[model samples]
Target: MLALSHYNSSASPLFPHFSNDSAGKLEARVTVEGVTDQPNFSPGQPTTGGVIVVILSMTLGIISNIVALIILANAYSLQRRRTKATFLLFASSLVVTDFIGHVIPGALVLRLYLSGGVHHEDSNSSDRMCQFLGGSMVFFGLCPLFMGCAMAAERCLGVTKPLLHSSLVTKTRTKICLCVIWLAALCVAMLPCFQLGSYTYQDPGTWCFIKVLSDTEEVDVAFVVLFSGLGLTSLAVALVCNTISGLTLVLARLRRKPGSHHSAKSHDIEMVVQLVGIMVTSCICWSPLLIFGLMTVIHSYTRSIGDDLLQYQTLMVMGVRLATWNQILDPWVYILLRRTVLRKIYLITKCQAGLRGNMLGRWEPTSFPSSEKNEVNQV
Candidate 1:
């Protein structure tokens, strides 16, 4: 098992962002046999193959997220649609979170590796940086989780209580809700910044993460249970809520009258389905990682499990990295489901091509009658 005390020592710079304890000193030592001494196996120690994967994932994620952002920003017609605007806004926020949570962090890890695996030292600046990065990661990570819940709820309202949805789900109201979601996530992420035991660098020269439990067996077990339990519980709630909402929308659509209005309703159903698909995909990708993360915390706390080192490391690595694919996948979701965005992109491309072609062509202006000539002819 990993020893909490071993990680807390001064020599390792895994978490250079937190301050040393009141002793104003750190003991630096390297242990070779135990979990504490084991390679962290996070982005810090990413193999050459892993680095290539990270680069590809981050590049794709950033580009896709940027496209999603542009779709939300420029497609005014899409914004005017009722539930679409709300969904688009949430989607945009999710993209932002994904960029921060995955791409930026991945880049930092790459930079660290390039610098000879030197860890950040615990200093005032490092502590602040840790607080910022950790806080942002938590905030963005949770945003999509909750926003999925919100999107689900909105679909439920639109289906089960169309009148109410029509009255309540306005652009301004959605903006307010989005703001609230962000604020709540920020609050959750920031809780550790103010407390000492709440945040720590994982090691002197490795990844920084939340300190779930100490090296003590009892504490480690409890810590694992806490984080795992919370993550599972949240996953359950989100899944249930989204499922119910999706069903409600489907049922409502079945009862609608046939016409252009019905066709529009069908489109709405498809959009909801796509959104639900995104939500479900996200849940699947994240849930296992959360469970494993919690388990690691528990196992580390107990110090009883020794042979599970490789398994634990694999789980941790998978949990952190796999969640990133959601960002890369989001742009495809928008393109597949959003007609307005597609139309606008097509029009813009066509206009650009036309202009270029005209510029390349040897062209002459067509002669037309002048205003004076036209007036004399008429007289």
Candidate 2:
């Protein structure tokens, strides 16, 4: 949800000076005699219930991400037997970014709750913390989305130009691509501070993001062109690439007319599922916030302070929660939808249960999913 930010020294008294921006940062004013201070949309410690909920989310998200990482590591080790797919490095990088997106903000948001608005307790320190956390959240949150775009693009290259892809999409190149993803995310997140766009804390005070609304025509144009433009571009590219890749697998399977084996068809289905899961989950979780931001900017909605806006703020908080849930789900997407991670998880379970009899060798896989690389992407 698009939101605003501000800090009120005390709880909003009738008409509290706390106003929010499109980025969800609260804007506050300090009156020195007759002159009013600039707005500071710092976070406020709202209900502990919110903190408790996010803490649990953070816990689950962290655990799932760790499990995914372990599965990837095991799968990567096994991959030494064959030509390791460079695709896995992208997958691992995405998971890492998703983990950061969850943990870092989750902790900072928890502090905002536990400390009861410590950011407001001292403006100087809080300002510094806000700047850091605001940028950190934006960078981490957007990084994973773009990384998905990178994955989609890579898959497209692999399908359309296999020989070239095999030659060009090397381990070193994949690493470089990942670095570029992070660097790009960092640059976009910092643009708001330069007055090109806006970033701020929103209602409930746990999250900060790009401003969705513009106070003037000039800023409104900038917000639309940069903030919404970048988000939509990345999401559109990801969706298109994933859709094309999924269709290619399905068509390839369909084309295997006479000698089409059951396993081959199943592999096509699995690929479709994985790609669809990623695309759908991402859209469901993130599209609302971005779309709403665009609409608000176009309409030129004004950011207002006081208790009257609390209901609107409360409703909008749902968007933020959904986006956070995406972080928890990304790792699950890998484990549940991808063949390699799924097989690893299955083996790990058997191992922990002392079912060595089920094991073929020290680390050899006994599952059908892992028996053939032609069926699924490695890791």
Question: For every candidate structure, what is the RMSD over all alpha carbons to the true structure, in angstroms?
Answer: 13.4, 9.5
Cα TM-score of candidate 1:
0.68
lDDT of 1 by residue, 1-379 (tens): 0101112222223323334552324333222133454443322332465456556676777777787778766754434566666667667776676666666556655554444343433223236545555555456666777777777677767767878999989878888988888787777666665442243344333334455322434433443454445446656766676677677755654554332133345445555766667776777766866776677776666654365665665566556555556566756676566544333444456557785444222111101112243433333
lDDT for position 13 in model 1: 36
Global lDDT of model 2:
0.60
lDDT of each: 0.55, 0.60
- True lDDT of residue 87, candidate 2: 58
- Candidate 1 stretches with Cα past 4 Å from truth are 1-48, 76-79, 118-131, 196-206, 212-234, 256-261, 339-379
TM-score: model 2 vs. ground truth:
0.72
Q: Please, what are the lDDT tens digits per residue for candidate 2 over residues 186-265?
A: 88777756776665555445455554422335663565556556766788998888778777765664465443344433
